[model samples]
Target: MFHVGFVCAEYRRRDGDGDDELVGGSGLSRSPSRSRMIKRLESLNTVISSIWWVFGFYWIVVGGQPLLQDAPRLYWLTVVFLAFDVFFVIFCIGMAFVVFLALFCCIPILAIAYAVASTEGASEDTIRSLPKYRYRPATVLSTFNNLGMEEVLGARSGLGNNGSSGELFLHSEDSECCICLSSYVDGAELYTLPCNHHFHCSCISKWLLINATCPLCKFNILKGDTLV
Candidate 1:
């Protein structure tokens, strides 16, 4: 009797297996687990692709223009900025990009600033929130004392009027690139800000993207104003 029961059980197992196959073949039994896994993989790929795209752009920018160059300070600063720029581009898209980009850009600006601040004679300066003023194109050329604008002039401070601001004057057509503080000969390329402050084109471009303020007086360039 026991032997017979075992044979019957075996037959039942085979029959159950066949029925399950038939049901699957007829599409009555859906493989929900496989479907879910495929969808999850696709979503993950999309996220990864977005991140890759952002970093690619960020690296191109960093490689094109390094902050410190041969200076020891440049290495760590570069790492910080690269990480920040990549993270900014990845998570921040659309209007949010502007905010993250501004923050990432500050990494370099502050790095330069801190270097200057740490120097023996340079005064300590902190960037408070910039005040908003009306945009006046005329102020771009005028001096800081003029009404069209106030503050935000020159490359370095203490070198402008009394030669005590960040502003540096160039007598040699190639004397010094105000932006990077490197010597430039004629046709080296420079950008003259509304404040009559000159800098390397790339340097000023980086500055404008971050603050739209003059490195000298904190003038709001986006407001159609200058530091001069």
Candidate 2:
């Protein structure tokens, strides 16, 4: 009978599963058995372990991660912006360096050119080179004939020994060739610049081959002449 009573009490505890409702008498709850309590604690730990993880045994503070594969949206956005900022800063620095290098290289060369132009004169200065053109009939010819006029300056001046033509021919003949300091021989071919400045065919031809500017007015011959 004593063994039977002990078996009955043990059976009641097993049925309880450490739950309050199974406790006998007056319906009051009882503290669970130590073994039951331990099992319950272990089950709770198992569920938590699946959701949260701790890593790094050697570190002072272990890092606990809630999710391994998926990060927070805000966190990844922050990382992307930080990466872009780094590239932008590097590009700005490179551009600034290029600008500084350009200025440093150009200033002295410009200063030297200015000095040469001032001291030696426009003709002697080589740095700002005048664009030289091969003499073509279009650029060096006069407006007196079709070779010169080509309909552009036909009304302004005419062919003949009268009016503007007379004065111009007379003046051109009396004046010396500015480039070579030579006299114009009668019936010799003369090339006239758009500036209406005339020179010997040989002198002006060679001059155009060397420099495209009119020797008297410094007008660029390649640019259409501003007939005076």
Candidate 3:
């Protein structure tokens, strides 16, 4: 807070083009990482303000004080001017703080709000109105309960992650649920959508609710569709 005013004051003197170029190309406005962008800007502003504030003090001490020993008339005049300069600096610092805070702090927020708000297809109502399903695949034991030892062993073999080392008893185009990026397992609950796409129960539910579309085919689930 000590040098906040000074830093803000110095900002008025800085080149707008450099910052504009950096911000314009940064893609922060189109990103969900907008919060991170703001944090970085605040940190960078503090560092820059410190540098400018320290240099200002250094210049005043090293440059201004050296000129006071010439003569009485000049000495008094210098003293009066220095006093006025100090007051002027203080006033400028206050005004500059308000201007900079208003200008710099609000730019990102407003830019990002407009950038994202202009987009479509996502809303609280869409998410809240989404359907959910709790799918349950048959248990392996039930399928193999009355089977022979060889059949039971083969069923156990297909449970391998890639089915690379096993007999691959359970194999299909839907072997893996893309929404969760995971392979289906026996008794794993899932949602089979109206588009005939299936995903882990929680995975597709969350995804569909967020975008209201099938993660695979982009089927609009909110438009008279439901979980199968």
- Tens digits of per-residue lDDT for model 1, 1-228: 333554565566556657878876443244445445545665676687679757765665677445345554755665676689667767767558777777789777998797554322211121111211112123224544533233443223333323222333234443554557776544444555556555665666666655566676655544555434
- Greater TM-score among 1 and 2 belongs to 2
Better of 2 and 3 by lDDT: 3
Across 141-186, the per-residue lDDT of candidate 3 in tens digits comes to 5346546545754554344323232222234444688865778775
Name the runs in model 1 displaced over 4 angstroms. Answer: 1-170, 225-228
Stretches > 4 Å off in candidate 2:
1-108, 111-168, 225-228
Q: What is the Cα-based TM-score of model 2?
A: 0.29
> Between 1 and 3, whose lDDT is larger?
3
TM-score of each model, in listed order: 0.24, 0.29, 0.28
Judged by whole-model lDDT over C-alpha atoms, candidate 3 comes out at 0.56
| Candidate 3 structure, TM-score to reference | 0.28
Candidate 2 per-residue C-alpha lDDT over 106-211 given as tens digits, one digit per residue, 9 for 90 to 100: 7878977875443322233331122222122322345356644545444333432122221133235345678899865545445566676776656776676666
lDDT of 3 at 108: 82
TM-score preference between candidates 2 and 3, better one: 2
Tell me, by TM-score, which candidate is best. 2
Question: How large an RMSD does model 1 have?
Answer: 27.7
Which has the higher TM-score value, candidate number 1 or candidate number 3? 3
The residue ranges of model 3 lying beyond 4 angstroms of the native Cα positions read 1-173, 224-228
